[model samples]
Target chain A: MNARAEFHDPATRAHLLADKARWVREQTLAIHRRAPETRVASSLSAVELLTVLYYSGIARITPDEPLHAERDRIIISKGHGSICMYPILADCGYFPMAALETVCKPGSFLGGIPDPIIPGYETINGSLGHGLGVGSGTALALRTKGKAQRTFVLLGDGELNEGAVWEALMFAAHHQLKNLIAMVDCNGRQMLGYTDSVVNLNPLDAKFAAFGWQTHTVEDGHDVAQLLAGFEALLASDSPKPKVLIANTLKGKGVASLENAPLAHVMGVGRAEIDAILGDGAAP
Target chain B: MKTTMRDTFLATVLEEMQASPDVVLLSADFGAPAIDAIRAEFSDRFVNVGIAEQNLINLATGFALEGFRVIGYAIAPFITMRCFEQIRVSLAILSQLRPMNVTLVGVGAGFSYDVSGPTHHCIEDLAVMSALPNLSVYSLSDHTQAPLFAKHCLAKPGIKYLRFDAKPHEPVCDAGNDGLIERGFRVLNAGRDLAIVSTGYMSHVAWSLLPELRAEGIDPLLIDLVAYNCVDTAALEAELAHVPRTLLLQEAVLDRSIENTLRRMAGGKLEAMGVGDRYIFEIGSRDQIHDAAGIGRAQVLDRILQHHAALA
Candidate 1:
């Protein structure tokens, strides 16, 4: 059965994506309530982006065979900011949903930073600025082997500070890796402060454009429809250049306290606050 | 005829690339004459990532993760030190979880680039590369060992670092003796008095000093330890069992020297000789730089004679 067929209705797909985003946010907060070590704000910033990718049927993945040769590879480079992935992956049957409770606990494979030990994860992450180059390599490999599978990497806006990312940026463009897609969760805030105040990457899209990438920007990253539209257009484009989607997003999108906090990256939501937000949601 | 280890090793890599469709060579803008042929012949598979060492390693890790055997090449100090965290995180740490075949070939061991100044001197690589848990450090002594080590890389499914000397030297290993290469060491000469254990370029130095030591009435054994971590310790222990005293020498710093490992394995019956625990700033020939670093030929002979005297 074609999984993408169900989401062809714009209204129904929008409703389903928005609903999944809400569930993911609630699950993220609930997971943080159990494992405070998880980066809640960073994870929250990327919830919509991840939801669009996993639920929109754009990423070709099989829970039964996570590392299947034909599957499109997704590298969550900003690993610490991807705690939201654990719940979504569990919901997709990548692992037992019951294992979500043991996240960051003793002997659990799920740590604060995700490794390739998880079935769905493609690379060792948490160390920023590694995913793009790795994804480029995979894209190159797939292209070399005459495979049509694409390689996607989710990066943080702050991760662009790493010079290695630029090296890969130059490489992918020069090599004309059209099969590679980079989605940057342009959440303004970094750990200590806003990326603008820390090191201004004000014209993010232009920077990628200047690097010779086919660039796209979604003014409202939280809007699932906008994200899905931007992603699908970029994915479908036949341009020989590598593509990047700059989704300008808000850090700590839903929670008010964290949304305004300068140090939201390190701030953890209290159990009571989480209970208040997700009043009647059952624990996974 | 003498040939640079990089040329011989890369020549073998060129063969591997021809034989296997899964092999890919990534370079960090560091090249040799042999690489020119690879670039011309296998342009599709040969990638020059410019002078970016970190990306060189990360890209190689990406290829290896996708079941491609990767050979990443670069200058010694920059490859091991400039992108250390990348190697640690991507290759060394990631390989523990995934099956990877990535061999990083670092040229210019020790003072091979003597005239290029201190930055090119890769004296600390032995200590740093060997410190990583899962990575094997292959220190090639001569051009003869390069092809074998290159083949060893294709057969192994783990992370490895090949410390190839920039200069060329005559074949040191006897012809048709790959068995010794697999054992990770070769007893160049058997002498009951003293065994001078070394690796890479220092093995050449030890080979040169052998007859002089013998003339001084102190018969010495030369063991070129090629593979740093994948050694047959039982065989090595048996070889060192009868030797009364051993001198561990390397053309590198004494702090965390490869000699330190040999000293431990020899049951404290060994002394280590290497460059002083400081960088050499004096501009001179390789031997003169060695003189400044206190590992010169005369200094090494004197140390060997003193050690032999103490043993007597």
Candidate 2:
């Protein structure tokens, strides 16, 4: 496509995206070490999702000009869980990589929750269930303006509990906002316990399909290849309805302690555990 | 045959939309006769987001983020209370970092939805909305001045809340609107004995009490407060400096209404009247409800007479 599409071959791009996903994972954990307040496990769950969107060049971005008119709009709806985006955005040149060190620190834009104050962030986030409605509105505006650019919203599986998300879902489909894309990081865990125990969100794909959305289920969200293929298929579709990728992922995708742990959402990984995980290849 | 504040305001909004396609109007399934024209003329720009106020606000924020001046229309209580967090986070908090132009036009301010019960009465809006920084709150007194405020909303950037009354009344603040948009308030009548400050429908209530106050040898000044937060506070302070006592009248609950603002400005030289710590369940007219709440025309007149006696 454009000069930014570094790898044209799908297989080669998938391999490159896999390497970038790991790098993003290490960087996210490293930042979590410095800023212990970050939701590290939640961040870990979204590594491949964010990595595929940014690295695979499926999203049209102008990193230097964060608010570039012609660029695609990406709303990180689940703000607290997206600390993985810090390193990816930095590496993409939206901001200096050094800024990642000051996350959760005073005067730093990168706080426990990602706000639009940081470059590449599209809206005020962290208050769950708001991004999809806002993204739908943005998508409606673009479609009304007769623009072909798309709007993407990244939401957590637990966030589906908010009734406002369903409102946006209906609005987008009724408006036939084909340019809107929603990716739910189905980590299956919330603050206290598993999402199913709190409130069931299974059959999420069928639910979306019933609401008149084009749905795709990415079986292994941690696999960069699978994530890339899912995104490519959704992006290539000419469906008039809004599209959603139900990316089924573990709450803590990697690390033995957090993986499958019901309370992984609020759990933090200490520096020693991080060092053991990254071990000798931590540098970005 | 009187026109409503919402109709006048939306008529002006329709004109603004006709002038610039960058202006967008969204309703939460709320409709008006004027809105019919908007939907007919510019169906592409108007959206009825069903009966969801939370989504209405979120959508308005999205439109504003995309550089469009947005107007979100809905019932006053549901628009502000039902989706308060959405307004706070998206418009209030987000506008601090981004240049947003969104006007939330909430119909049925105070007891305008008279017989619709307490659920429709929007009494806490002024207090709650003013608590948020960077939000411009406008409580319209009549339909005549609504177009001016509507134009101001389209011209300005940032968040504005236009609290329109559901009922229609004769024009009150109609001295040709000179400097009305800039001053954010207008001095309807002048006197030196006492200054009576009121907003929205309460301004009409206070204005109607002027004759009885003068009949009792009391010279009272009446001011209609339009823009609650960004009013020329210094100028209003200067106007109050001439009067020995200021009386704050409103149709909101006393706990968090503009009464607090005027009390602070008057430096303890003010007596505030409003609905005090209770919801009216009585089925009656607005005046009857006002009387039950102890803020009716007769009660306000009695207070003015007492203030005049104290001045004597």
Chain B TM-scores, listed for every candidate in order, come to 0.81, 0.82
Report the Cα lDDT for residue A126, model 2.
Answer: 73
Tens-digit lDDT string for candidate 2 (A170-198): 99999988899999999999999989899
Give lDDT tens digits, candidate 1, residues A1-284. Answer: 33344555776998888888998998888888888878899999999999888877888877778899988999999988999999989887789888889887765778788888888998887788889988988899888888899999999998989999999999999999999999999999888999999999979899999999999999999999999999989988989999999998888888888998989988998777787798854543
Each candidate's interface RMSD (Å, one decimal) is 13.5, 13.4
* Model 2 misplaced stretches (Cα beyond 4 Å): A1-5, A280-284, B256-312
For model 2, what is the alpha-carbon lDDT of residue A120? Answer: 92
Docking class of 1: acceptable
Reference-based lDDT, residue B305, model 2: 92
Given the true complex, what DockQ would model 1 score? 0.23
**The best candidate in terms of DockQ:** 2
Tell me the docking grade of candidate 2: acceptable
Q: What share of the true interface contacts does candidate 2 keep?
A: 0.57
- How do the residues B119-208 of candidate 1 rate in per-residue lDDT, one tens digit apiece? 999998888887787798888888888888898888899899999899877876563345666588888888889888898888878888
